[model samples]
Target: MSSGRMRYAPTSKLFIYSMSTLYVVSPPLEIFEGLKPELRQRIVTLPDFLRYPAGRIKGITRSLLAGRVALPRRILYYWFPKAYFDCLVQARPGDAILIYEACNVRVLRAIRPYLPERVPCYIYYCNPVGTTFRRPAEELQAIRALGYRLTSFDPCEAERYGMACTGQYFRYPEHQPDNIDSDCFFCGLPKDRAGTLQRLRTRLEAEGLTCDFVIPRTPAEKLTYPQYLDRLARTRCVIDISQKGQTGLTRRPLEALFYGKKLLTDNPEIARYDFYRPQNVFILGKDPEEQLRAFIESPLAEVPETVRAAYDVNEWIRHYLP
Candidate 1:
């Protein structure tokens, strides 16, 4: 497990051989919309069962079953026979196969036996290990055994799993306004941190700061990706509360940099990154209220164009799939 700090660029041979590519991505297709046109055209996506009603039901059922039963590694083949068949029939020698988040464990297993020995296989894990709802440990090991090149968003987790770390990427917006409506913004599942977040909000409000803190209790309350970004663009600062055991940077900080907003995060390790600016980012810890107040009052600094470009989806794709 090398530190994710190491960069991966595509070799001349890889570009020459990767004329055809298969992408087995999870739902919410808009995330990959920023891919270069040529790369998008070269890649084919597998069926996302969550997009259809019957498939959604199967997904929910499988999730419930997975909570109570340890499913066999190959069960996904039976659950998603169409996807398994498609991967087997569509993949060719020298083709590139990119699997996002190890979400489709069975498909990976089923397709492994059929993948041409010369083909390049890569799996990117967006979530930290042990956090996934399915058999994460087993699935990761299976992916390793099958010779897939693994990548993770979390640098520490990448090292723990012995995988490459490709930090999170964001789609650079066509236009981002300088005007801001709120002093601070945050929206996410509570993940058992509801009380702490609520208290933080209360404290901020007591300081007379405008905070748009949202902890959606229902699915309808959740914002779409675009809606989330829109809200982000309207805020002066973004608050990031890392999940337990998470040391990797999430997309929030990168989003702040892209939109020119300040960041207040509990992830102290962010201070180690090259792009970290004390004037722009405040790590929450002792006397967080004081830190938050000062950070809000301070002028936002200009992040270098190179730093911003490094996290762009276009650059990320070039590194991962080049």
Candidate 2:
């Protein structure tokens, strides 16, 4: 409810225009705190399912028809949520447009025409492209040809797709940190990082630093946002080791920034950011265990309010616009 993306109109043409009201269509996430209240209210969650389990069949059917039978938008549009309709209907040329998450593209395609004329759209990649987007090059090429602006936080992706390199965004809750019980903490779906996390945990423990690592095996094992934040509250630092070769700064560093905690990340790109502080961050592979231990014990360098403000979702929206 707090932060998902809004439904969108298609990216069919370019309009030399700017709007104070930005409509974002993204997969559900909880990190929308950076925007003002009015902007925050515009977010809409994607892949909205029916109230009952049986409705999923309808979604699957819709996807199938759109793919196989070439169902026309006039008929397929009914499958979307009313929120999607309202977003398109109420959107004016004065509003900014953004789309995220690969799954939501179908919805954008389904109701492309209802949107304002010649309003350019922005698609931001929040995760690594391969992990989140499975569509072929042709699909993306088609999207780009239609005048949508593609962007990502990953420099590699930006180079690969010719997308505008953009900054990542986050906002922490007002909840204060709990008394620190561990030296470091990490929680995420264990996609190939399980062994690496366990190894890091052991190494940290060997160095006399307690590590709280949560690598969920099943969907049920995944922690809700509140639960994860509670764990984060207890740690002096947060650990972020990306899948090998992932160089982009993920949310871990931002979490560390907002929570006033240190971070152990493997991202070499961290050094390139304005907030990078040797005292506050320990890069994996670059830092020996002894160095990491010292980093955990080091006094966290304070990030200025201005530096922190630059990473907000609001700033992310404003940065990529023409």
Candidate 3:
């Protein structure tokens, strides 16, 4: 959300105020439930607005052409749900628009014609490049050329790409988790981590821990957010395995912090975060098995609700919009 965005509302395009609203355009993920109700209204998922190919061949053709042929890409994207674009055209210059990094530059280019003048538009990366995204440097340059600012959740990635390092967050409902069906929980694409997750599960089970590790083969096979969170609510510990080269704070650690579940991750950078407590977080490689066992056995530590709320999407957007 630290990515600067261009937003326009119903009225005047004037100086930014403390209360300017934010509009987010992201990939297909329901991440706004944790935001204050009013903030949720401005969020939009891109996939829904984009026209779906009627059949498999068209889908494949579109996928094949969207990246190479600019004319076809714009022609395809220009056909996106009109109402969503209308919101942008009508938005005042003062509002802020956040376009998640997942939305490619082609999509950004397609929307350029409708963008309000000097409307702050941002490209925020929730995932690291080369890991989940293969966007080249030219793409960032093109994005900037179109007057959009770039930001990332991972500090290392931000530094590597010359982007603003915004903290990764979880948009989860604020409530104490009461269920406890498993000792550990994990759900994600294998992404070269299948063997690692399997071995880790074996070790945790050897430690007498019941692990609910869901290693889906693809994103489509992944569990829904509600299903994943439901599993998290029933677990005592949340597993945090970064994509092969990533060392960023993922949603797993944040989920652990907000839900009072112990964190079991390979990301040592988490130690630098304020909410990180050794008693509650067990670094996969750095911490000993004994420490991990203790962390698992000990009751989860308490994190203030206020601290959890600080990660809310509303608060995150406010930092950039304000």
Task: For candidate 3, write residues 85-132 as lDDT tens digits.
Answer: 555555576677776654466656656666787678777887777754
lDDT of 2: 0.69
**Candidate 2: stretches off by over 4 Å:** 1-20, 27-29, 38-60, 67-74, 103-108, 320-322
What's the ranking of the predictions by lDDT, best on top? 1, 3, 2
Off by over 4 Å in 1: 1-18, 22-24, 50-78, 81-88, 103-107, 133-139, 177-179, 286-288
Report the lDDT of model 2 for residue 267.
Answer: 82
Relative to the true structure, candidate 1 reaches a TM of: 0.80
- In candidate 3, position 297 carries an lDDT of 84
Residue 188 shift from truth in candidate 3, angstroms: 0.8
Query: Please, what is the whole-model Cα lDDT of each candidate in the order they appear?
Result: 0.70, 0.69, 0.70
Q: Ten-residue segment with the worst summed lDDT in candidate 2?
A: 11-20
Kindly give the number of clashing pairs for every candidate: 1, 4, 11
**Model 3: residues with Cα > 4 Å off, grouped in runs:** 1-20, 27-30, 38-78, 172-177, 218-221, 304-306
> Model 2: per-residue lDDT, tens digit, 200-273?
88888999888788888888888998788889978999998887657888888888898888988888789999
